[model samples]
Target chain A: MTTSSYVYYPGCALQHRSHAYEVSNQAVAKALGIELVELDDWNCCGATEYFSVKRLPAYALVARNLALAAQAGTEELVVPCSACFLNLHKTDSHMRQHPRLEQAVNEALEAGDLHYKPGSVRVRHLVEVIINDIGFERLGQLVRRPLYGLKLAAYYGCLIVRPDNVLDDVEQPMLLDRMIEALGAEAAPFSMKTACCGGHMTQISETTALEMIHRLVTNASVSEADAMVTICPMCQLNLDVYQDAANRMFETSYTMPVLFFTQVIGLALGLSLEALGFGQEFVSVEPLIEKIRDVPPARSKPERRPKQALPMPAMPQ
Target chain B: MNATRPPTFFDRVVAATPDGERLSQCLQCGTCGGSCPSAADMDYTPRELFAMTMAGLEEEVLASNTPWFCVSCYACTVRCPQEIPITDLMYTFKQMAIEAKRFEHRSTADWSESFVGFVEQRGRSFELGLATRYHLFHHPAQVFKMGALGLNMLRHNRLALRPKSIRGIEQLRAILDRAKVLAEKEAWR
Candidate 1:
């Protein structure tokens, strides 16, 4: 059964680097009659780097958040960041899958006088809860202002739908597409919808990371999307902030606005731009905001050449 | 002719990873290699890396940049017909490489260390600190290049100048300390 209330785990990046996501997410949640209780004293989920550094310690670190969420008395723990969601969900399942790991992690948890069962608190991404719990039907009804004439490409970064195809189809997820359509926007056909955003590769390998980012933006441009709506901070940061770097490296001119899905949802809910953390983005979404219409575009047939008219002859050289 | 020989590098990797025995089931299929977005940048495709590991090429495997170039997108793991957990094995390989001090790129190691350092210090990661320290240590020239981006983040209020410590920091530290001991007991290093 889906619940209206959930324990929120705003991972470190969300609290600082992705504060806009947190603000817009909270506003959208409140408007939808969903209560998100912040898990008390929540620490880092160790991200991806920690696991590569220390495996057992990293599991224990992520399990700490799970232990806290379990103690918070909420049956579901909703996370905003894709990396955080993956770490929390992966650790929980790993503990259940491996007894030795479960015992070791539990022993570490004993230091804080906390213990967590693998399935005590269900780990979910914020997008998952919004799509599954409040649902598109209610979301459509709650749209105070439909975002018409706005072409949006739903970009789902790597971690959200991988390792386990729990949330959506691994190859071609439709939840993001459906949600965008529910917002009264055209969901452009994006081929690189589930491509990697290079994560920390930007810091690790500049050339390789920029090439990946270039592919994403170039694809979105080909689709003629007004903006690319993303569900993860790292994706947004890479596509928005590092876009200039990619342009410089590739010598291509591409202006694609990357935004958090919550911000887009907030706009549909009639929330103000400032309230939705609009200005926090590196790429200006102002032009795109002006494109939203009050009503959907009229359905009219495309103009065709006159039946009697002959095709234009090629100009003489 | 000996029936009992020491565990090969492949055996060590399989043993280190949870449910990693599936590594033996790898069909040398190119699904993982084809699915990887950064495979072009990798010195060896994941399939070739696996075969090399089975041949006990520890030095070449550890020093290769394939694992570090991985974005951890798990495109390979979810699609692996053998369910070999290719991504998890990547993580294991990264850890082993770190232990061997065979980092093909020093910046990758420094980046992870700084990230883990901040997490240990304040119970949460400080992005600004992590970035500043990493850039200053590894690529000082790139620091100036990233100056505008950093300032832009600051202007937008996305970058926090100060790190915030969680209320249960002491408890968190104790937990990490215990976990470290347990990790050592596992003999990972």
Candidate 2:
């Protein structure tokens, strides 16, 4: 945890479908002086679908990555994709909890001449690394081009902070919001922040997925956020790629721009658009970029509470 | 003379789940169902499904579309008062339904198989291959509908046309094969 360097595990989706996230993450990391060493010869972590079909094999698949990371001798393994992060984290945690499963997985690993001790290497999400390792004070000082007038809705699709609230609150995560604010952008009140974007249901059950996507876009639209920022590639893909399909299915004219948190951070860091991989988004961010003001707008006045209204319960510490 | 009932479906599920002893502690609360984003799409709510499982309604439970609709967001799993690992149980039900050939939805299973097929062959997932193979086999009409999106991805250089194999794919294959054997042995046990 002391080292600013980590073994980077860019899951398959980030390598193929979400290059914007990869480049921006790297650019941001470099600017922050954090060293990211890519894990060599890594394979798929089976995502969510693999575990459903075969449980033991899925653990072994993710364990292979852990083994490789351990072999690389890095204390921390930074994974960008939410699904990959969850799979790797869950595998390690479960291996520690269930000795039988660990024994079974290690038996499989014997074939590859690799073995991993549970908890040998820590699995972390990239956002957590950037936020925790390099605090907001450092990020605020480093911001060259503040995203002043932009209103961003932080979308933390399920996997990153669930099944074990590894990073933030399960129902209401604010790390993304805090990051948005740290970048000098307004964090919109998006209630459906933790809502599911239907994962691969777009392929399996199109009707249901479209409806789910429609709801998410509709929430951001109602909130009047300029764009929705996300950490998971699947969330971005669902909201960005299938936006048109959702629009057609719902007959709504919502044009919310979905972006990766890294891309937004890169913008605030004053990096060139090309360096941040901006042009690759299905929804063009050019118009959103135009809305960036040189300085943040004046803070809006807080609404006065009603005399009869009861005090809201304090959030758990 | 003595009479005894067979092991319930609940018993089978609990036995299969790694930490499934907690399943018996389910409060019958609808939190899982209420928290589920796709609960409306499920034939039976998670609470109802749990009751049905304990009642030994194996065929009906397997045939239900409840498990297929789960997106694995894990909202229900975290919120479950009983901490029943509700999401993992969904995976179990999906596997069981697929093995029994009792699942109502074919396209979901097909998509999963196609995804795993790519992973197995190349040690990585090929989104382009998964999309083409799945849409072509299941919804040929939707291919034309999704053509522009596919072209858009290619235009942005986001979609890789070719699948890349890892150098240690042979090692990966050996590990996966051994894992498969272990899974089968566990199932038989």
Candidate 3:
């Protein structure tokens, strides 16, 4: 591992709607001998919406957390949530790129008696640290129970890999695939791996969001994957919470359980179900749990996505 | 710092954002429009929005539901051949529409407004509270539609009634206040 420990930022979602992600993440990290020191007094990331309403205040809102993380004096600040990671990474990049933004942001920070220098702290997604710093070999070694029979579809939601994709390829990222493989599961083929999960559109326009959700769930269902593994809380929430809504809208039944990569990793590392918060999912992973505990999926030839008439976009190495 | 509204909506948007000035580099490739998942529901596709922006349709651009409809998935911004920060541009447009108070999709705009208000007030979001306020004021029908889902989440403890305030909420408020001042000072009048 690059370093044994780093500062961790679990944004608001983790505290409420996505607490399971935090639970599983911490369990998995502990199992792997990683020390995640939570950031002190971090505020919301303003998510994807606030920035649109008040640009400067939103930057300050996102920047405040960075400023706090910088105070921790850790070289690496890890964020689990995709939105938080992007906000912090984007702020760091935007600040470094635009000195004026940095200056204005710092000026606001000064009001709270906080100081931050842009680019001083390395902002990273949690999965990147696990895959890169922790190394897949080491990760695979820590797999005590091995996710033997699970056919997993890795869903890399949009924020983590876009415009400035730091962790994975811009289009067809495979970091999640590699991480899932390290956990000893078959990384099932999924075409909508990098597709947007309609994000907050689920709240804005239900019909449109449901359509987008239907596409992702249908594609995953078509793949016959046991469950779709995700890194983002929003992606997991949208997929997990809105299955009924999606089914009602599209008249298609999709029972694909959306599990966080950490949750699955925790299971592979032999963490308890309660510790991993498995039962918290809206779409019960009970059937998948039966597979994990009693009868795991064998390495049988799982169903694959039919060859697309249109070729998928290529990713960088 | 002062009222310097550029004649064109595109120009105003570009001028408003320090980083989004690159919209002029657009190739009209329709990559943004094509990549957008919600484009079918939009009145003006991202490409058309850009065209209208460049055509100096100030009021039309400000009032267009395109910005409100944007889910900020960043799909268009990611695939833009010109490397334009289309998502951020959408944000810039959203702020402009809020200031102009002429949103085509008033309910959607109001939803975003209520959310932002929730975050600013408590330094965190209370999803249940925000939804109730927004639905009751804007689209009361949605409340009933989402009632079961809301109840389920509440029962599961996924949704919380009490808001979670950050430890140094006072500091957070101070930062937000200062930022608001800076934004007002720096925002194009």
Candidate 4:
């Protein structure tokens, strides 16, 4: 088996606002024996609006980072943020599809002395990497502190699962659910799994943004999950930092710690709260972590469904 | 003159609006109104506005201050059970309303102007220009405090004093012109 390692693109939010995500992601990956190589000269992903405002420059902004990743000789780029993953993936796809866009973007990149040919690098989400490459069996093996009795609401925010091309499934993505289950935690059956967590909309429109966040948090809280597990930094921020504001806006009392899946994985891997940057969250994970710590390891149960043989058709004489 | 004049229908307000997809998919769950941070201050809810627009109540849709009150947070769109592009629709409607001179919000106009200034000067949003323009427009006292911060940022080599323009300004102008024409066509109806 060829051992796979990936170049990690932590994007701007991970570097600044969601530093806990980077910390947890790195620690968990290290514990699992997967090497996460941080990209050397990565920049902002230009986000969702930049492309709409100015297409060529947005492509160039994303392409510059891709070119850097390619130059570093890494074929696979693993992005933890859904918005970054979408921006990077869309830029790559669009550049390959449209030669004019590619040329203009490359020309802009010339100033930075970086250039990338479209399709040269593959962009993969962290969830996809863990579910596909690491596999459930391997993940199961790495679980020293199995998250038994911990009910988790797997929140896959809009950017990752939208546009259909880069996402696993638009309507119902099971990747996060499966990963949570692999950690020995109960994945709460919630319908708002693929809902949008108002991205930078919090800055542009507070009322509208709060409403969006209120629904996601309310659903997760109502699901009775100890904490909401997410893959994207923006999703984590909107749900975590904005929870209080959203609650106040709605005049509803609700508290749910929003955490990156990596942090949960770190806890499951026997890493300490300090290692996972647990205390860094605005919505305290201390109480939830204590609950997680109390639970015993999950007991292996036999398969419920009986093995059935394929029915053969009777031949007519 | 009154009898000869053609009656303006509700659809006229909504006709040729750019963000029809967002308006069409609102689920009327009241999640938007319930969660909106500014809902206490604003008159109409995003859900209600969407309902009105979908019902083709154009004059009410355009004349109402709901669109201007939107902060563009993806919260509603994100939490939307139907996954409507509520913010995008607001942006489109706000732009249309401004072009028609039917509604005017000074803060929004200032924001748009600052954005345009940034793009025209540096081919991107420069922090200094944005901050200065915003403070100048809204609160001039903010300029002194921001000036101190700007100097500190410059000292740390964060803010670039000289703005950099893209290579093809003419091409950018042509694209902007095309977009303006499209906006005008959408607004007139």
lDDT of all predictions, in order shown? 0.89, 0.89, 0.83, 0.69
TM-score of chain A of 3: 0.91
What lDDT does candidate 1 reach at residue B47?
98
Ten residues in sequence with the least summed lDDT for candidate 2 chain A: A1-10
TM-score evaluated only on chain B, model 2: 0.93
**In model 3, which regions exceed 4 Å deviation?**
A1-3, A292-317, B1-7, B187-189
Candidate 3's residue-wise lDDT over A164-283, tens digit each?
Answer: 877778788988888887777778889889888988888777888899899999888788789999999999999999988999887887788999989888888888889997767888
lDDT tens digits by residue: candidate 2, B35-140: 9989989999999999998888999888888988999999999999888999888888877887887647778887777788899999999999899988898889
Return the TM-score for each candidate structure: 0.94, 0.95, 0.92, 0.66
Q: Is the docking of candidate 1 incorrect, acceptable, medium or high quality?
A: medium
Better of 2 and 3 by TM-score: 2
- lDDT, residue A309, candidate 2: 75
Across B1-189, the per-residue lDDT of candidate 3 in tens digits comes to 346754456656887776667888878889898888788888899888888888888788887778877877788887787888888888888888888877477777777778788887888878889877877887777778788788988777798778988778889889889988888777521
Extract clashing residue pairs from model 3: A149-A297
What's the CA error at residue A251 for candidate 2, in Å? Answer: 1.8
Task: Kindly report the root-mean-square deviation of model 2 from the true structure over all alpha carbons.
Answer: 4.4
Q: List the DockQ of the predictions in order.
A: 0.76, 0.71, 0.69, 0.07
lDDT of 4 by residue, A13-112 (tens): 5654567788888888878778888887455565654433333454565776788889999888999988888878877876786665566666666655
Candidate 2 lDDT for residue B55: 85
Model 2: CAPRI class: medium
Candidate that would win on TM-score: 2
